[model samples]
Target: MTFNAEPFTYRIAKSGDVHISREGRLVVMVRGNAAAKLAAALGNGDESDQQLLARATGNYKRGNERLAGSKRR
Candidate 1:
């Protein structure tokens, strides 16, 4: 099965707060030093960055999976 490559997005506010969203819904707001660190890590914009965002929002996998062919048609 296919999954979204970039499911999470982020915004940096003027106040240096990091706002992370999933599908247009705000999931977390990071501030201060933590926000700075997150911003730097996200700069790469790679697969690992996506995974970091997922973990930050506690959205990582929880053992629920099924092969594409297993889906009832």
Candidate 2:
């Protein structure tokens, strides 16, 4: 599976809240120390930052696994 983080974007509110959005839709609003930490981590806006955003919005994989079985021909 491949992950594309381009659709994720964030903005810092005046009250120090981090507003995370995906595809132009708001996903989560982070506040307090967590918001500060997230803001710091998102500085570079690289792959790792994307991953952090994904995790913050509960968009990451949940560890459930199952390989596709061979189809009967």
lDDT of 2 at 1: 30
Candidate 2 per-residue lDDT, tens place, 1-73, comes to: 3465387888999998999998899999999999999887887856777788888887556665443344646
lDDT of each: 0.79, 0.81
The list of candidate 2 runs beyond 4 A from truth reads: 65-73
Candidate 1 Cα errors over 4 Å, as ranges? 1-3, 62-73
Give the range of the ten consecutive residues with the poorest summed lDDT in model 2. 63-72
Top candidate on TM-score is 2
Q: State candidate 1's TM-score.
A: 0.71
Q: Between which residue pairs do clashes occur in model 1?
A: none
Ten contiguous residues minimizing lDDT sum, candidate 1: 60-69
TM-score of 2: 0.75
